[model samples]
Target: MTRPELKTDPKYDDYDYPTTAPEVQSGHPGHTTPEQDAQVFQLRTQLEQAGYKERLDTLCMLRFLRARKFNVDLAKQMFIDCEKWRKEFGVDDLVRNFDYKEKPQVFEYYTQYYHKTDKDGRPVYIEQLGKIDLAAMYKITTGERMLQNLVVEYEKLADPRLPACSRKSGQLLETCCTIMDLKGVGITKVSSVYGYVKQASAISQNYYPERLGKFYLINAPWGFSSVFGVVKGFLDPVTVQKIHVLGSNYQTELDKQVPKENLPKIFGGTCDCKGGCALSDEGPWQDPEWKKPPKWEQPSKTSQPTTTTTAPAPQAASNAGTQAEIKGAQQAPMGS
Candidate 1:
């Protein structure tokens, strides 16, 4: 038979699909144990089979404390890597996820972390609704001139108003998490939090808030201090009443915007209803408190500890336990 003619246009070769594994599997004896590529998944299974449950948990803690998200694969791989790191000599606190829960909350799983500093004059660290970059971690691990410089750069990116865990502006972020999905835009900023609610809300109004509902107060009360850092007793009930009245009938609009799975439950306080609290007891700030509204546990935390240190303790204290050794070395003779 004549050999298959080679096409000069090369469509057949270009259209070719290559396979590293066979398409068929058979239970017949002596199949020669498949091939090397066929055993590719074996390493993952072995790593899983090795099963360092505690080690894995610790890794999850590492990611959490360092502002990492947790998922099953990560929990497992972190366990393996932590063990490997210990064997290689970088041992200690293989887990410390900045929290105390077995599984992180969904909001915790999907929020932002700030690495921003390009537009600042002071050191700040901010977290909100987003992700963190473990590979670029500058706290301490690698020892290089560039890595050293990064620490200085990060200091400027920090925000005085933000928290390490970063609080939301209100239920606004929870709203975005719910509404944006209906429009098909996935929020990816690690710095997204309550602080950005206005910006996101503005975007929603022009782009998708019509699907959500009316924005109750359009940039009200003038300053963020008007919301946070103030006593609930001092809050003006009327201002809140107006906002509630403005967006009161939001459900009909929500039904149109959200996919059924993303439907928001009627939040008594954090509810998507801009109308005020859904618990008939409160109609607006008129109910006497957004501070500890009904159906919510834990009152609002409007202030931070006055004594909390904004920056890491001074270098002298940072090396507290090792201070004696460090001082002795400095005093040692050059030749001795």
Candidate 2:
């Protein structure tokens, strides 16, 4: 007797860029087991029965399932709660219209931005927390606005950024490689930022799950171990495994994960954008060949088609173009 055949998405074969075989075979969309496939279908049905009108795609469902360790009931509840939170948070409206007009001002005090991709073609998001001045940042923009901007950025990542990276790298990229700088962070600073950090961590772990690919905490100061002990309570074991705690001598390890040419100079890399890495928002997502309007901005069927450059199909098992997960911007570690 033959064993069951692994599932695969045929569309990926013809995509302009190839989907990495590993991603397909790692229990994701293209290579799910029969049982896992059944779970996805069941979750979708339950969601539809419960009146979830959006984000019912296979990839979206799988992320929630993985977050809950593939427990269908738990995944269903997670999806329901996420949908409810999206409604209450006015996520749709925020995605379409919310803009961080004070982004520059906020960046001056607390830097959090996506710069480029890492070795595995995942986007590299950098957060400079050592110098964060919550008091000064709050004066420019309230914590409420900061969180709103975080959500908007996450939405963009799911659509244009990840899709563009997948197309450019010939692979399906969903998560991000993060660098959390902790050079100047101290106990006093940690306490000062605890409130915002807690709120941000809750949002990332609860609403957006399984978006973290690699996490690095560099320039860890003394007494970081004790702080990390408390921080671990907020993160699950899988997420904790993804994290790497590095001391001031982090350049070598960081370079091993991220190519020096793509890394920022501050992190002992050579890349220095004309303006600054934080504000540049530079990546394949902005590349003319790959960038396009996000899913939310796409014209409706009633609207006439316009001539414009189009991006290749995002070949994941997605129907509504819905995908988003982020532990981004949270940068929640022992310090800062």
Task: Please report the candidate that would top lDDT against the real structure.
Answer: 2
lDDT of 1 by residue, 1-336 (tens): 432221212211221111111112221111113332123223234343554222121112222222112233443343344344333431122111112121123223322111111111111111121232223322322223222222221221111111111121121110111111111112343233323233332222211111111112111123422543343233233212212211234445434332332222431112343432211111112222222222112232222123432322212111122222212111110000
By TM-score, how accurate is candidate 1?
0.17
Q: What TM-scores do the predictions have?
A: 0.17, 0.82
**1-336 in candidate 2: lDDT tens per residue?**
433332433421223333333354445656677899888878877766665546666667778988777888878777666665776787778888887899888888788888889998888888887778999988899888888877777777777788788887876777888898888887798789877776776666666766778888898888776777677666666667778888899988998899998999999999999898888988999998877667768542221113332332222221111111125344332111
Q: Poorest 10 consecutive residues of model 1 by lDDT?
A: 327-336
Question: What is the alpha-carbon lDDT for the whole of candidate 1?
Answer: 0.22
TM-score of 2: 0.82
Q: What are the Cα lDDT values of the candidates? A: 0.22, 0.70
**Every model: Cα RMSD to truth:** 25.0, 8.7
